[model samples]
Target: MTSEPAERAGVPRRSLLLGAAAGAGAVALGAGGAIAPPAQAAAPFVKGADISWMPQMEAKGYYWNNSSGVRQDLFTILKGYGITAVSLRTWVNPSSDPGNGHCSIEETAQMAQRAKNAGMQVLIGFHFGDTWNSVGVQNPPAAWAGMSYSQMLQAMYDYVYHSCNVIKYYGVTPAWVKIGNETNSGICKPTGSISKPAQMTGLLNAAYEMSKQVFPSTPVLVHLAQPQNLAGVQNFLDAYRSNGGKWDITGLSSYAQGGNVPTVLANMQTIQSGYGKPVMQVEYGGPVGKPTQVRDSLRAFVTGVRGFGGLGTFFWEPEGYPSFNGYNSSAWDESSRRPTAAMDGFLNV
Candidate 1:
């Protein structure tokens, strides 16, 4: 669910709120004042965490202890570390996984309230489906199961508009909203797939238009995975624009894989130079135990993106339990559920 162009032409306005730090558990990544609160808790350069999973984790009786090994409220601790923003993902009608209370729209609003109370900017990441919509499978909500391509566009529009209003009514207007999640194959696929370029553009355009109508000032982005996959990024965006798609910022994903940091940075530059769109590393993660290298890699990534006028770098689930989808490198100390040394990159920036 997502809107608008405060950007040049078709690009969306960008705030770049993602952190490129390692997964967090315990022992905050850095020890310094450099990781000050997000520019007085403003909109741009919002330093923060994607602890959308926190609420669900809480429901499952999972709690994090502070550096003192005392259990503490998570957001309070993040704020203490100068984390000034929070991100959440909502599905059209998400599944009720026992550990997933935060995926529902109402539940997400509840978390948004918590984030706002913690003095953090909120980002509404709408996957626009019943579950995660990523590069592999972009399923539409069951509600749209039998709809035609034209009908799907209207559904997207309505979904986004409704998501905007829900968050706004809850007293936490999102600073950013994504039209879809990791939509390299296009969103709500098959008819709305990038393979069907024109139809996909229609779907995205509908979401874009309806989002602006609801929250005209909020920036909207189209997310894609693997910034290092330059061809994928280029092809998808080009297809979107050529088919009359509109977006504000170009949102990307980057994870440390086989020493791909340089390629990630290079791809960001390529997107900026080729599309003239401000880039935002919306998702990044590094090795969990390798504190020194993780810190340096994250720093280099943030620095590299900065060199090319990127909005910012964001870590996907740095504080995740089970190390972010079972990849140990992606999470901070799962036991502590706090920051690790890799967070030094975000802090010192």
Candidate 2:
């Protein structure tokens, strides 16, 4: 599914504050105007990649699974390329269709195990929907369709707890847990509107509470799509902080086609210094159609983010593409071969 438009479209704002404080304030700066020193850089700011539907990429007749020996080979390639983390998406229950079987919890756990074995950190992305869930589409699972809003909230809490428990129990402790994917437009849709700051805060708070309950030590990341829009980022954080919501890390999803990398990096620095928290480019990639441009953009973006105090980054999909018969061609070839140009970008960065 395509991503939703920016929620702050046409909304004019007076000031862009990182947190709840109102009025103009001094923007914080990293040491020497750079995010942590090179020696202190944590895990190369995570030149990472996301592989939610990789299993399907193989099933679609693109590549065989021999390269990674059950996908871990992909991580091995990623590790060789300097990628320190991997993100996986989980759905409550996807359709039984063979092509759409990417949301299985068991499968996700196995992938997480592979990543851990490969020495890569894992980020668990919970969609909360049975299918593709994003800010524009936050439909709950079918089982909870008839439940009231309150019931839905409880259900979300339970779902998060159970999922995190499973991951933790399996010895694949996710370094970061995103309650919902790209919540810029807000989850659960019409009912979950960030326009109503109070209501929005309530929904996010429920997720935050659940994460803290499940894994108190693990940092919960509040993800917003598109980093170039500073006003939108500030507005969401303001609303969140106003409603007593808290997050360990400030996360942004930036697509190369959406905005300038420098602008996005600057905005990230502003938010990180303002909030005194580490920032993560949680999701980002170049246009998948242009493989060469995608590679170049990924390299530039990763390097820029690292210089800007970025805690980490994850390429959207290194091994999935629509043109390859709906297969992801970023990481592997039809024979499950190792290291595509896109995969190498992460390592080379």
Candidate 3:
């Protein structure tokens, strides 16, 4: 995610990865960004959105409408658009800030249950902080500040374990569990930064193991932002693997790439092939007004990734219309209060 606190806060997670360069020790990407799709077919692809802001939006009296202009529930509208799943983010103990906070475990579980009731699969994103964690900032929770590495590891484990159990208690089983959101720089701040590979992997392992213990069948994802930065992603994953990091899926964020689908696809191909993991586009979005362009880009990406056997993509906050929280990349229409053609990208894929 990007570094802007306001923008990141508005999305209930990280901002779109923008302008960030590769980290130190990064490898140079191979020449020629374009790559042919893999031979394997990707079936049961997940077409989803990160609607973590729905509860807060609903609380603020925001609503959605169908094409005919009739008010409908958010999930109903999303289902009509062919969204098969929803991604929800969680924080350690978020504040009540209207734009920035309110992703506590209880709220996350409630969202999960709602998604399940809607017959949509759930992706649980653990931010591992009181607010947001992305490539720009991975601040450890306030309660975990100044904690020794070992202490924080236990804290991370307990938090993930308890959170998973609570979600299960609410009768919702997650389809995917991300150890951290956009953890290109690693999670939980100084102690878990990618610069310190050992500490990073240690914390990741704790989160991974605990998540598996709870949902042994769910895929645990290791997410990194900015797939366009092939070197940065490769460096982080190299470190992760060298340090014995474990994950079932390699999640990526493809945003603001200036329509360079070839580059993004190349990186996804490399990661899926190199790490031998199922690569997924966990977050993506285009500006709100360019519905046609956004729709085309989304369609291209979904088609390209699926062609290469990459996991499905999730549009980041497509519901953020009228520029809610200063977010301008949502798929909703400002005046009509209905979904634009942007979401058509996910259809017929």
Please list the residue runs of candidate 3 whose C-alpha ends up more than 4 Å from where it truly belongs after superposition: 1-43, 256-258
Give the per-residue lDDT digits (tens) of candidate 1, residues 1-349: 2212111123222111111011120013112222222332243554656777777667667777665667788777676655677778888777667434237776787788888887788778888788767778898888897899867765665566556666666678777777888999887767787879998887776666655555655667889897778898889999998875667778887776436788778878888778755677777777787766777787787778777777777766666667334556544677666667777766666
Ranking of predictions according to TM-score:
3, 1, 2
Sum up the clashes in candidate 1: 18
lDDT of 2 by residue, 178-259 (tens): 7777777767655566766676665666666555555555677888776678887787787777776656677788876424
Which of the two candidates, 1 or 2, achieves a greater TM-score against the reference?
Answer: 1
Cα TM-score per model: 0.82, 0.77, 0.87
Q: Which residue pairs in candidate 3 have backbone atoms (N, alpha carbon, C) closer than 3 angstroms, thus clashing? A: none
Ten residues in a row with the worst lDDT in model 1? 18-27
For each predicted model, how many residue pairs clash, with residues at least 3 apart or on different chains?
Answer: 18, 10, 0
Q: How many angstroms is residue 147 displaced in model 1 relative to the true structure, after the best TM-score fit?
A: 0.9
The C-alpha RMSD of each candidate to the native structure, in angstroms, is: 11.1, 10.4, 9.9
Q: At residue 253, give the lDDT of candidate 3.
A: 90
The number of the candidate with the highest lDDT is: 3
How would you encode candidate 3's per-residue C-alpha lDDT over 29-70 as one tens digit per residue? Answer: 111211112321334787889999999988887888877788
What lDDT does each candidate get?
A: 0.69, 0.65, 0.80
